[model samples]
Target: MTEKQPQARVMIVDDQPMVLEKLRLVLGAHSDIVLHVASRAEEAVEAARSFRPTVILQDLIMPGIDGYELLARYREAEELAHVPVVILSAHDDAVAKERCFLLGANDYLVKLPETIELVARIRYHSGACISRTERDQAFHLLMVSQRELAAANVLLAKLNGIDELTGVGNRRSFDAAMAAEWSRAQRQSKPLSLVMCDIDLFKRYNDAFGHVAGDFCIKRIAAALTEQLRRPSDKLSRYGGEEFAIILPDTDQAGALLVAEGCRMRVEGLAQGESSSGLRSPVTMSFGVASLSPTRDSDMTAMVEAADAALFEAKRSGRNAVRHAMEMRAGQRLNA
Candidate 1:
């Protein structure tokens, strides 16, 4: 079955009572038209704002605000600007027709138009107005959708750089942070320190408990390491399996080592707590601290290599200790 179309709204503005009555009689026969009448042009403007007519029929001659001036006003108003306006006049003069067209009238008609012609004009203009309104609403919705999509992209970018398991910065975030901090330190001639942390005998712990327990252990250790660093410039990230990294901006070897020692102690204390699985082997961590006064020519990779070397020495010297990069290098030369 075909659907019935909605009723078209029509507004009439005329100072003469006879003209308004004629328009009502002509429009009353059409069941698809809804008519609104206003005796004054001022009332027409207010009615247009509230009633939102699809088409308007206005008499050319009216006292205190003629139809020509009212047509210009309607064209200026944002609400009624798009509604098709038809000018109605008793005299069919060329000058009056030309003047009405210049003032933005959509159509011209006699004082008492034929019923069929009036109904046809109203239907065509009202259909055109409805199409324009639909297009405007669709464009607005498209713009809103684009804005929401852009916001979602930004949120996805942030989540992409985060570690899902540890709830900390991942390796990607770490690399980005390192590059920015290294550049800042080089420019300001400031010291930058790195700490490499590894869980002591993590494989053994996983073998004793399950992988689920191992995950819990890692998360707890990550939290403890985070709590040990107080400054905003200190950043921690999960480097790899059972390993974490800390970046300390504007920090020397002494300061970095102190922070690393506190982190080691915090993890050790957590390990001493009773476990549900009765696997209460003291979980300890070893830390390697390296500090460098960055220069323009220095590479950030060299600092990471030095920290890795210190981590090797810490593991070799039994677990649960902090090793400095300079001390590790000196001992390595002596051994060599």
Candidate 2:
């Protein structure tokens, strides 16, 4: 099927009332073209801007800002730049046509061109202008869609790293962070600390209370543990159910022990009261602390296993104590 062309908007700029009326009367007979006439050079460009003309018919010798200057103004306007301008002058001088072309005129014609030719030029230019406008709008929409997609991908990646229940970094995120921190510590020869923690008697607590209350307890304990470390380099993650691991970059054994003890106290303070009785449920946690001056030869697994072994000792000695893996090794060496 053939597509119909949109209406052409033609604007005539001339100081002569007769010329303005003549162009208007001739062009007005065509139903497809809408006409606007400006008799002063001062207002012609502004009028065209507001009317949004598809084709401009400009006279070269008008008063106050000559037609050449008016043409320059229209060409400078971003909104009017794509609209084609046709110069209508009385003289057919080559120099005058060259000046108009240099000032960005699309066409030059002797005044009072044949009615058939003028309308044909206007329709042709208008159709091209409309097509360019549509193309620009489509390109702008495409750029916007690409930006929105990029932003959504960033948000999805962040969400994937976060634990939904505790609002802490999940196990996958912890592994990545541990590797990066380990490399940094090895490069700098700085001490790095790991603190592994488990909620004491958490199974018993969940058995006594409902699973929903247990989840709530876990979230509260996580927040308390997060508050213990003041350094921005420290990170906390949900390593397993009711088990959390802390990564302390550039921290020694003493600092790690202090942080673990602080976490233990804060969680113990979160003792929630039962509804049936005025007694609070015991909310103590056990901690296993390990620190190392990391080397390139060593990997994260050694540190993790050391912390896990210490955590087992803490659970074995009593549910609420803190155990240090390095300290236990020194004691064993002395006894041996």
Which candidate leads in TM-score?
2
TM-score of 1: 0.65
Candidate 1, residues 232-272, lDDT tens digits: the string is 87999999989999999999889998899999888888746
Compared with the true structure, what per-residue lDDT tens digits does model 2 show for residues 1-336?
A: 877669998888988888888898999999889988888888887899899998999899977899789888987999998789999999999999999999999999998899999889888888888888889999999999999999999878778888889988899989999999989988998988899999999988888987888988888888888888798889999998999999999999999999999998877767654343221386889999888877755657868888888899899998788888853232131111
List runs of model 1 lying over 4 Å from the truth: 1-132, 273-281, 327-336
Clashing pairs in 1: none
Q: Tell me the TM-score of each prediction against the true structure.
A: 0.65, 0.72
| C-alpha lDDT of candidate 2 relative to the true structure | 0.86
Query: How many backbone overlaps does candidate 2 show?
Result: 0
Provide the overall lDDT of each model, using Cα atoms, as 2-decimal numbers: 0.85, 0.86
